[model samples]
Target: MELQFLGSGDAFGSGGRFNTCFYVRDARGAFLIDCGASSMIAIRKFGIDPNTIRAVLITHLHGDHFGGLPFFILDAQLVSRRTAPLIIAGPPGLRDRLTTAMETFFPGSTRVERRFVSEIRELEPRCTHDVEGIAVTPFVVKHPCGAPPFALRLTVDGKTLCYSGDTEWVDGLRDAATGADLFIAETYFFDKQVRFHLDYATLARHLPELGVKRVVLTHMNPGMLARVAETGCEAAEDGMVLTV
Candidate 1:
């Protein structure tokens, strides 16, 4: 399995990084972890063929997390002329949120016939669902984004990958990351106790207990980005790729 960081920046685009988006492709298929608002541009900038993506797994409804679906769909329809179905799996109300976002961004977009199919799959907390060929399980987390936020745990082939979407300290995270091959955590701060987000300092302290083989810290602000190197954890940068 292979994992690539297409975009690894916070909502504010600190350090000029793109919004959060990760591309994971194995022999089974290719999918995305989070399609942030700027995901389309990021994908294009990285010279990726967006039509190759089969599905997108979202952790929450926050704009920075799943807001780019509208543009991604449009690209697949108008630009790439995709014929395969695209799966969009996320928390409850994902269908509504996606429709609202689509209409809000490009008025009347939801009513258009894109010549392709987009499947919306709403995921319940702790339930493992098969998306395409990937197994996705969502864990309830602390962030409140007008709906339940989740920390996603994905398994493909025999490799497990976990991501602490955007949340503060939540015990469920430890469970999601347990036995994972790679755990991509959102550490927005370095040491400060910020609400609804994790910090590198606190997350580092718990790393030993998570029992994960590798950890990549992501979704950082300017302060966290500056101090990331000193933390000694592998930090995510736009366009970085890893083999799992």
Candidate 2:
């Protein structure tokens, strides 16, 4: 499996990074891990076909993580003229959040059942679900949201990818990343102790316990990528690609 960093910046697009979005693909179809607000622009910048994305696995309802869906659907219909069905999966409130997002941004745009359509699946925490051919398990994390936050562990083609979706340091993180090929953890702050965001120092302290073979720091802010350390752990760029 190949993981592409579609956008690696945080909510503010620090260091000129777009946002926290990624594309995972292989011989099978491609899937988007997160649809951050700047994902479409970054996808176009990388010269990748956005229509190639077959599904989206959202972690939460935050704008930085899921605000790009409405525009992406519109772009696919209007600019790309895509006709394939799209699948979106997330926490319990995913359908409602996407519906509201569509209404707020593109009013009356959800009536595209005649054209392309989306199958939004709301997952129960700690429950495993099947998406297309990928087996995904959602784990709760520490994030202040109306609904519980989650991280995703995806296994496809015998490859595993763990995503720490905008979480603070939580015990479930070790379980989420256990025995994964690559752990994509968010590091939003530099070294300070923050409530909802992860920092480098805290991650370093917990790294040895997680037993993650390879880690890629993502969802970074300007301070992160700008002063990113060369400590064997890679920090994701706008177009960085990793094969697992």
Q: Highest TM-score: which candidate?
A: 1
Tens-place lDDT digits, model 1, residues 1-244 = 8989988999999999989999988886789999999999999998888878999999999988998899999889889899888999999999999999988889998888877788999998888999999989999999989888999999997999999999998899988998899999999999999789999888988898989999999999999988988998899999999999
Q: Once superposed on the true structure, which residue ranges of model 2 sit more than 4 Å away at CA?
A: none
Residue range 143-233, candidate 2, lDDT tens digits: 9767778999989989888999988898788788888888999988768688988888899888888877799988777666666884457
TM-score of each: 0.98, 0.95
User: Please, what is the whole-model Cα lDDT of each candidate in the order they appear?
Assistant: 0.92, 0.86
- Runs of candidate 1 exceeding 4 Å displacement: none
How far in Å is the alpha carbon of 209 misplaced in model 2? 1.7
Poorest lDDT segment (10 consecutive residues) of candidate 1: 109-118
Model 1 residue pairs with clashes: none
